[model samples]
Target: MGARRRVREVRPTDGPLLEVEDLRTYFETRRGLVKAVDGVSFELIAGRTLAIVGESGSGKTVLSRSVMGLLPQRNVTREGRVRFAGLDLVGAPEHELRELWGDQIAMVFQDPVTSLNPVVRIGRQITESLRHHVGMSRSEARAAATALLRSVGIAEPEQRLRWYPHQFSGGMCQRIVIASAIACGPQLLLADEPTTGLDVTVAAQILDLLQRLQHERQMSMILVSHDLGLVAGRSDDIIVMYAGKVVEKAPTATLLSDTRMPYTEALLRSAPRLTDGSHRRLPTIPGAPPDPSDYPAGCRFASRCAYAQPRCAEEEPPLRPGAVPEHTYACWYPVGTPHGAEALELNRAGGAVG
Candidate 1:
């Protein structure tokens, strides 16, 4: 079976295209247990883009890696369920996962240089997945690789395929990686900071290309990033993570306008805005994220939040619905609310609100 072999298509259903339920990925280290991804849950619809945004140590990468089953299993323990297209990926056999990897699910890693094989030619790199997953013949795979390169807007597709990863610039290498990821037309795509090392212009081009390709193929995508501005307008839904847990989640527009979580509000304030004066200093979130190995007993973001109260330090708030439907946040003193204002005042007055 070659490209003629029809892979099962995952159509839009009454339920979500992907459902993650309380996923926890923990790693055992010499220091202690590191809770990389702690009790995170979200959903993605068919042909929609879900953006996971957080700071460097906020577990965004770990969450994505756990979902894709890319983490090393030696010292790792993964709990909870990751249901994709009605299949439970966490319990799926190795062979089953392998079969779905390129044909039904694929990932574009953060760095192309580290992800690609330095010794292998670009053509072989792209064709390998096609030949294996799609069962394409040698000539057919070669032609497909060329077309894939062209689809990603790479120049001299035929000639470029003969070159090695080191021969191309960083942006071009990233495009090649994207080509390889979509070679089999996977139903789901995980782009882990796909534009990480590129310049602003190149990053926009890459993001635009990803958007265009996702729309054309009707592919569901998870864009993992640390920059809020990058995903502000690009994604349909947004999940804000802090210290390995999701602090807030909502439709992009709703989250931007009606933010509730203090951590999320701080993140929005920290992002560089085009409307800001050139000389204006950008606001920065105070305090580093809590150590994952020994996280605080209560709310993870309490130490850094100005509105935090004694209750925040004593008990963690559960993720619950906000004023808007489908918007959820784990915050007792939600921003822009009377309770939040009173909490801040109490905090400044050296009084325990709770």
Candidate 2:
């Protein structure tokens, strides 16, 4: 055990803790094939955070679930490589994935209410992983669970542990859920809408807690959210998804500054900013997201994009490296390019949303 720990310590920090390659997750629905996460790929360096942002139906949640191999087996078809600590997760056996879950990888689900067992006490929820994975005795697990709750900002940790999930507020329950997720000090944490259903102040606190925990544990995290404002400042990198594919990906600053992909630009423009006047109308992206059951042969976002050209509606654009390093976008007429500007001008003159 000491030798194994020594090897991990000697490993280079530059190595990717998680590498996803051409991941595709489809569901065989009664209507048709639902391509929830289609041909998406990304990598995360050790101890960094990657934020997946998109509209509700853009499949950010599904992508995160696919990464953890946490989908139902009945109609789900997941393809491609998910390498975590150099282990391929896509085709790994159930037992192998079970060992990885909660110990090496953990998830904080979208809703805390449904995630926590209503009948179970808070202490059991937090200590289950600790006792099972770390083999801690009952007393040791109890003490560790108390510390975990305290670290997550839950007051009266010892007293609260004995209470049922129904007894706590949403914020407190969410904090307890987080405590359970971090119990084993997982190397990677997938946080799907960690602050969902939380008030603004509590949401901010939750985000701060997550960031603080990530830093202290040096764990890689994949944060999924629909709000652009939430991710802009928090994540090291951002990936924008549309129609089950990554339309734009870049460092947080680069993507915000040198904005590319018309769809991504629309999302940014639509997000309400603090600087806007109270009465100012909120901008919205025109047209609905495309259906995933029967995907378009051309670029999926072309129908709603102001800069889309004939080429965009005829041929799909491949995700390629941009002029800037570590940036990739899938678009025929990328925003910030001359053709894109011209197309936007023409579309606006033609009474299209621009």
Candidate 2 regions off by >4 Å? Answer: 1-14
Q: Kindly state the number of residue pairs that clash in model 1.
A: 0
Q: What is the lDDT of residue 338 in candidate 1?
A: 97
Model 2 C-alpha lDDT per residue in residues 1-354, reported as the tens digit of each score:
111121122233456989999999999998899999999999998989999999998999999999999999899999999988888899999988887788888999889988999999989999998777777778888999999999999889999999999998888888999999998888899999999799999999999999999999898899999987898989999999998999999999999998888887888888777898887787777788988998877899888888877888889999988878799999888899897898888878888754
lDDT score for candidate 1 against the true structure: 0.90
Clashing pairs in 2: none
Q: Give the C-alpha lDDT of model 2.
A: 0.88
Report the C-alpha lDDT of model 1 over 1-354, residue by residue, as the tens digit: 233564445554678878999999999999899999999999898889999999998999999989988889699999999998888899778888888897788999999888899999999999988888777889998899998999999989999989999998899999999999999988899999999999999999999999999999999999999988899889999999999999999999999999999988888888777898887887676789999999998999998898998899999999999887789999999998899988888877875332
The most accurate candidate by lDDT is 1
In candidate 1, residue 234 scores what lDDT? 96
Summed backbone clashes in each candidate are 0, 0
TM-score of predicted model 1? Answer: 0.95
Model 2 alpha-carbon miss at residue 277, Å = 1.6
Candidate 1: worst 10 consecutive residues by lDDT? Answer: 1-10
Q: After superposing candidate 1, which stretches have Cα over 4 Å from the reference?
A: 1-3, 6-13, 348-354
